[model samples]
Target: MSTDLLQARDLTIRGEGVTIAPFSCSLGPGDRLTLLGETGSGKSLIAQAIMGTLPKGLCAQGRLVIDGEAFDAADSTSRRALWGRRLALLPQEPWHALDPTMRAVSQVAESHRHVAGRDRRAAFQAAWSDLTELGLAEAGSKLPGELSGGMAQRVAFAAASAGGAPIVIADEPTKGLDAPRRDAVVELLARTPEAAGALLTITHDIDVARRLGGEVVILRQGQVVERGPAQQVLTDPQSEYGQRLLAAEPSRWPLPKPLGERQAPVISASGLAKTRGGRELFRDLSLTIVPGEIVGVVGPSGCGKSTLGDMLLGVTRADNGEIDRAQGHTLGFQKLYQDPPAAFSPHWRLSRLLDDLVRRHRLDRAAIPPLMARLGLDENLLGRRPGEISGGELQRFAILRVLLLEPCFLFADEPTSRLDPITQRQTLELLVELARERHCGVMLVSHDPALIERICDKRISLEATPSVAKRELDPVMA
Candidate 1:
């Protein structure tokens, strides 16, 4: 008798000009497997194939077996019956996966009661325990919108695993989390295989694969370039692509150039404070940003990092603060969102959106081609909608959209959290170079402390309590 928890033979995905080559793998009891790749490399496609949730126009062709039940990957609905009972998937973006109107605990409890076949009271208690274990005991009553990116991710994980599924698939589980929270998530993922279940994770973070301590298969352009044990492959990779990817980690990046002489201020904020869900995010925060400078912000998840950016851009009202923008530059203030897909319309093609922006602003259409080339964006990508492209591509397009307006102040809220390491390094380099060339003031927010230390000319560290400290990046580190 075969005791494999999950198996896929010749699993292949095909769409228009793109094809994920035939791949095969299996997971047995107490086994862990991670698919390591960059955005658009077909990592998510393979997970979606097993889950039977491939996007429209893409089709999977392979044989999939989960918990001794076999199905055809081509049939998208074949695996729906196993969802949350024998199979559970934690999606890449928790905000989109979770229901906006439902409270966190209720969502998990519903899964437990319905899928796990537990009674109402028992399910509620189990859900509570899960949240408590994940350090989200107080967040149970909060809605998805009220939680931060990392908190919402934990709630989604709790809901997904409440059914006690033996086969677990997590996609980009630690994409936008701080070091401690990311480690916590890795531990939770490890618990699945530790309890005799099987774990299949799809992530672009090398550290995630290292922590998971699983078998790794590296992909590039939808083809496998390397496969081996985590320890051997991660520490000493045999493939060239894998080496490049590992070298792109922010900690390994070269130090950015030292800050030049100060210039006129672009934006200034004084005594900023915000309270959400009875938690004080920060208080008495004041800072000034000069043109051609990059300011980095670091803090724990849910510490109002995004809120602070919104207040500076005038998107949200501050509880106690006054913001000043350089006169005559009001139209130049813009923002780059954390989630690129959420900021765009799913129904419209990229060309349509770009045309709308250009028309609305009366900007030059001729400049689009040169900018697209510089961003390394292909011309064919313009024909696809926001959902049709990868997160990395959509983010570069977002940068293109903002740069066209010749902005003097840009607030980027965790802009590269979802990007793969190589693409992330490239994107930040371009952003910094452009900012310096145009003399734009950039308020850069990231969860990685090493990233901030390497690139920012100034730094702002926010705390959970009522305090915010702003200072210059130490020249010694450079």
Candidate 2:
């Protein structure tokens, strides 16, 4: 019996007139592998090539064989025939994977109808149950626009698992999710070897590679620089590039320094009660933020963390509550969104946006480079649009945009979740340092308990998740 289920022999891919050196790898039945690299390193490109969806002008050259049949990656007809049976792609960007107009449940059901050949009614039935199990039962009726980054991520996962395709390639599957949610993703992928056949994950998150124990391949500039057992490669890398990559992974954050004398509250709220879509998120919630103090807000998904941030910013009104502000408080509201790319205009060049933000805020232009450098961003990123950059890079840029504003209160929602470990540490450090130096009040809304404990002066947790029956029953009528 042949052990090789899928094999790529000397595959070379070229995009935008640049060539990636010939690379090769194989996956037997029940195999798992990961491709790790930074932005623009051709990790996604390789997946696209394998899925026969490479962008126009990109060339994939070499021999690919699956189940003893030669695979021509450039042939769309052949790919279409194979997809959802022998092959499938779990796209890195959920925003790109899902349809904006359709309800999330319908999209997943669509996956079932197309891949599993289920009848429409059966597909919808299965989809409802599947999404519910993935923690998206309440999100079934939501259009992609209405779902949060994390919510949409779960929707994508449900869709990917619907068909049980034999070969699965998931790209940055856990980028927008919290620890528990992402761990669930890892567990699901870990089981694919038996339920499906092979799993290939593409991510910069070293934790994912570590958790999904299997072969590890490090990609740099489109070349496979290192390949070995996951434990060995991640722990003691042989390649220089691999060593640098391993060194960048973040460890537990250091406890924050001692704080000074207490200050009066900058913003205070009491007896806050909020209900949305006829479902109560939280009730009798109270919190305060004082200058130079960091307040951590945490809870599980659908626990009103982001909603609380909105309420604090005065964008969402509480059904019953009074929020008091200190007299002459000019430093009001600024937000570092979880999905940074979604916040910016895709058509606007980074240069235009950054320049306008800096000049509008009277920020020193010279300080921009050093700030970006601290976050490991390239100055040249300014020339491109938000869609052209990587998620991690876009996140750092988003932080820079807000920091330049120098708001009095910063509602940072999952600010560091999208970042790699090393960059996560640096970004959080810089944000807190500047917040303290400027006497700014910060509310860190996150699901990361460790991070909250490490830096927060006082933590207030909201803990109530309305069931799907209440929220997903009827759309909020106009």
Candidate 3:
């Protein structure tokens, strides 16, 4: 009998004549392992290779074993059967992972159908119970667009866990979540592997690894730099790469200054109302953002967080609200979307993009290099296009572009949603520093309650207004 549940021996991956040399790791039953690395360090690539989802040009050469059975990458039928039944994956991008057209419940049910070979009714019934267990009671009827980042992730977890896969691979599972939600998701992931089998989690969040209590494997440039027990590697690492990663953890970042008693509001809104597709998203909403203050907006998914961000940035006009902007108050808003690649022009280099923004805004060119350095970006990266950069780098660059504008008010829409925990912490620290030095009022829109608690000076919850017929439901609800 094999001692290992999943084993990879001399596993090598090659792309474009360059080789990602053989690196091996093994997992025992109920054992969890985390693959740690920077954005472009082939963490996801390894996960993809395991799932047989590598890009067309890339080829894999190695030995893979599951429960003493030899695994062949060349066999498509065998690979498919093993993929979701015995080997499951919780992908990085939940938005893309889920079909937007289908209802959330239906998608989860479909996973059950495909993996467990359950009938349609049985699958649908299973989805509800699974969703409820995942803390999503009414998630069955909602589409992916209607869910927040956190909610979508929970739904994905439900789908993956429902399959009873012995080996599960999760990539950056808690990327954009707030501390509490991050904890919840991490706990769920940690517990899932124990109940079913072993787990392989790819993450930049050290906290997640620590909480999961697993072995740690540090990857750099498509190779393993270090592998050891999680506690030793995180708390007292011998490798420089491990040290750098530990340093990058979010806990190390300094907290923002608290908001003192204020006499005047820096930005005020009254009767703020926005409508789309004959639906009233927000109505008569009032809020104040003070200078040197971080106001966090939180609500359920599809509650108009992004729309409100647009209104704050003057990107979208409010039909009914009066927005009072302070005199000479320029808004240097850096909106970080969930898909960073979509925000930038594919044809333009990072240098060209920054240069164009600076020229258009007529900002100081001399400040660009220093600012980029402060954001931990190398001057060499300026020549690379968005496609050439990792998600984390692209996110930092996007924010850097906004920093160059140097506005008084900064409107960030889920800015750290796509970033790893390490980068997330750094980005938050950078934002706080910018706010303090520049004395800017920042309005942050996020679904993570923990992030709001950690970073914001004030928090506001948006409630949907009930219809006239449903007035008894409560006015305080909105």
Indicate which candidate wins on TM-score.
1
User: In order, what lDDT does every prediction score?
Assistant: 0.87, 0.77, 0.74
Estimate the overall C-alpha local distance difference test score of candidate 2: 0.77
lDDT of 1 at 217: 95
Per-residue lDDT of 207-276 in model 2, one digit per residue for the tens?
8899997899887766788999999998999999787777655445566775587688777888788887
Q: Which clashing pairs does model 3 show? A: 330-408, 332-407
Please tell me which predicted candidate would have the highest lDDT against the true structure. 1
Cα lDDT of model 3 by residue, 354-448, tens digit: 78877887889998888888887767667666765556777788788777777677787778765655667767877877876777788877766
Ranking under lDDT, best-scoring first? 1, 2, 3
> What is the per-residue lDDT of model 1 for residues 48-105, given as tens digits with 9 covering 90 to 100?
8999988777899989889999889999897898999899999887866789999999
Question: Candidate 3: worst 10 consecutive residues by lDDT?
Answer: 468-477
Q: Which stretches of candidate 1 lie over 4 Å from their true place?
A: 467-478
Model 3 TM-score (2 dp)? 0.74
